[model samples]
Target: MSKRGWIIYNGNLYTKKFAEQIKWLRKTAETFDFEIDVIANNQLLVAMEEGCARILTEKQKPDFVFFWDKDLFLARQLEEQGVRLFNPAKAIEICDDKALTYLQLANHGIRMPKTIIAPKVFVSLEDDSHLGQVIEILSFPMVIKETFGSFGEQVYLIKNEQQLRQKAKELQHKPHLFQEYIASSYGRDVRLNVVGDRVVAAMLRKSDQDFRANVTAGGKMYRYQPTEEEEKLAVRCSQIVGADFAGVDLLFGENDEPILCEINSNAHFKNIYDCTGVDITKDMMAFIKETITE
Candidate 1:
């Protein structure tokens, strides 16, 4: 019998870097007498319309599931059939919805910039009730995001009411947000990979030309120095999302206070490794082994 793991690299092939990583992982598994299988049979839209399993197998009901997408539709399907899924369905939901996660975090005193979730339809814009509340709670230059964003896409820093109105006109058909962008984090934020209640490694992502500091948006990474508090927050985020490990993005404010911006259930690690020389892949594998071995 062969030992095996599944790395769910969902979505269409778009990046050469990811393609290379998949190859590397396949080789690594083969070397260890294990197999790395790419399970594309459980795609979200395909599973919806087809209502069938095309190429999945009972034997391939993975022992270790590396989740790549945040949507739990497919993951929930896997669990009903007894295939263990990482990050669980509920965790996926909480992290997937930016508004709900911050509410929970705020209740726990975890620092976060002001955030708001506006519905797609405004039945009574004249009421000005909820709108007033949002304005009062969050300040200007607030960010509007599409809830599910990755690598810096779908993120908007709304500078003023005119901009917000214009943006709303553009994206009002869909649910969006109004969040306070920490000016201090202007082009700078920390991305920390937390594995199993520990901060494995962190990189400070800086965007000199853009406001979005995510590496995908032209942000460069450097050695990040996080205080114990930030580390604790990272751990807390992991727990909130029910992920034993996650990448926590923390933003610094005018006073240098750490603000929890986003929690990535499946964070990319290449840039961190390239800049900091920290290979979390091996450590993460070790942690997973230890977790199940016990």
Candidate 2:
């Protein structure tokens, strides 16, 4: 019998872009002669009764799950049922939170920008008590990012004390981080698509309008040839984060050194495909095939 797989995505997200990616992934898996089903996360119900967990569905358990959503609970439940997830549940949870990602990488001595996770604030406090220490450490013209966000939408660049204070106040109810800005990498960064300890493709992103270099943030991408150091760093980051595949963003630091930016367990690959002519879906399927056999 042929191996079966489940490609899980967010059901609530009704965007054509997301649908298109799923189509591409499922089609690629089909070309590999695997019977793959694209299922919505919400369609499957996770249940726990008398300390026993089960998925309340009539469908048979799959050999592997291609988890493309941030639903950590669902991912964990699937793993508990003995279905292998490509990046694993723990990796997804860690990468979903900016603070958690930094904490994990700190012990590994990775070259990331200096970052300070904001203290938890239950209520929106009126004063800027926490801002004093943060401003002193990161200074003005720093970057403030929400703990949980994507596409660079929740990241803010504060130019002065007032902007920092205002942004902090606005985000008091949310988890955030304060970091020193990399001036050398303004409006520019490199994205390396690493699959199973190897860099399949890379692109340099630049923006003329926004500080964020994410393509969704109106940045432009071009084929990039990563340095030896960059390739190693990207691969190492994936290993440290325990990700089977990841889109690792690197910022240009002093002397053209690579500074770790962010890790995406389910980063959209459409743009990378357009830029590098590399089909990551095929590599991903191949990697999964090799992994499950071992």
Candidate 3:
């Protein structure tokens, strides 16, 4: 019997981008003779009864799940049901929260930009005094990002104290982080797609319109070769995050050294494919097949 799997994406996203990723994953699975089904996260209901977990979907469970959504509960429930998930639940949790990702990587001595976690604030309480310390450490021209965001949508560049305070106040209720901005890496970064222990493809992204080098942010991409150090760092990050595969973004440090930016557990490969002509979906499927067999 051929191995079977399900590729789960966020149905609520309702964007062609998310659908595009699923299309590629399904294509790869077909090539490997693996029966793969594409499903939405919300399509399955997670139920708990008498200390037992069950998925309420009518579809039968597959041998594994290629989870491309950030619904932690659904991911964990699937894991509890003995359905192995690509990148796993814990990996998805850590990577979904920027603060947690940084903390875990820092524990392993990963080199990243200096980051400070924002303190939680209640909606009724208004205060910006605590952020003064952040200003002292990171100064102006810092990067502010929500703990949970993607596609470069909720990131901000604070150029002065006023902007810093305003951004802080706006996000006081949500978890966020502040980091030093690497001038050298402004609007430019490298994205390495790592499958298992190896980087299968890489693309350098440069933005002409904004500080974020994300392709969704109007950045351009080009096929590029990664330095040995860069490759090692990307793979190491994947291991640290407990990810079977990841999209690791590295900022340019002084003298072109690599500094960790962020890791995406369900990174979209369409742009990378267009830029590098390397389809990581195939490597991902192969890795999944080998891992499940092992």
Candidate 4:
């Protein structure tokens, strides 16, 4: 019998971009003779009874799940029921939160920008006095990022104390972090898509208009050839985050060295495909098949 699987995505995200990713995965599964079903994360109800958790769904459980959504609770519940997740719940949890990702990478010999995780505040702060220490560490022209964001949407570049205080106050009630801006890589960065232990594809994203180089932020993509060091770093970061596969973004340090930017557990490959013509879904499906069969 053919192996059965599922691709779980966020149901609330109704966009062609998301739909295309699911379509690609399903199409790739056909080549491997794997029976893959697409399901929304919210469609399955997680139930807890008698100190045990179970998924209440009419659909039959599969041999594995390609968890493309960041619903960690659902992912964990499925795992509790003995369903293997491609990127495990713990991995997704760590990658979903920028603070968690950075904390996990700390002391791991990963070269990243100097980052200071903001303290969690229950109530909004009335003044900018709390940002005194942050300003001392990472001065003007720094970058601020929300803990949970994608496509570089919740990232900000603070040019002065005014911008810093404004952005900090805006995100005070939310989880965020401050980091030194990589001037060498101000408008450019490299994205390496790693499957298993290898980088399957890479692209350099550049934006003349914005500090962030994410494609969704109006950046353009081009094929990139990563150095040995860059490739190793991407793979290592993925391993550290416990991700089976990931899109690792690398920033150029002052001396052209690679610095860790961020890792995406459920990275979108459409732009990389358009730029490099490399279909990541194929490698992803192959990896899944090999993992489940073995």
Off by over 4 Å in 3: none
**Residues 200-281, candidate 4, lDDT per residue (tens digit)?**
9999999999999988898999989999999999999999999999999999998989999999998987888999999999
Candidate 3, which ten residues in sequence have the lowest lDDT sum? 121-130
How does model 2 fare in lDDT? 0.92
lDDT for each residue of candidate 1 in 1-294, tens digit (9 for 90 to 100): 655677666556537887766665566545555566765434433243366643244554567666656646677776666655556667767777777677667777778877778865654233324555666677677788887667889988877767766676676556667788788889999998988889999989898999999888999889987899889889987886687668899999788778899887767677878988987776666675565556
Q: List, residue by residue over 92-146, the lDDT tens digit for candidate 3.
A: 9999999999999987878899999998877832767778899899998999999
Identify the superior model by lDDT, candidate 1 or candidate 2.
Answer: 2
Instruction: List CA RMSD, all candidates.
Output: 3.3, 1.0, 1.3, 1.2
Q: Model 1: residues >4 Å from true position, as ranges?
A: 27-33, 41-59, 122-132
C-alpha local distance difference test of each model: 0.73, 0.92, 0.91, 0.92
- Find the 10 residues in a row with the least total lDDT in model 1: 40-49
What's the lDDT for residue 243 in model 4?
96
lDDT against true structure, model 4: 0.92
Q: In model 3, what lDDT does residue 293 have?
A: 93
Q: What is the lDDT of candidate 1?
A: 0.73
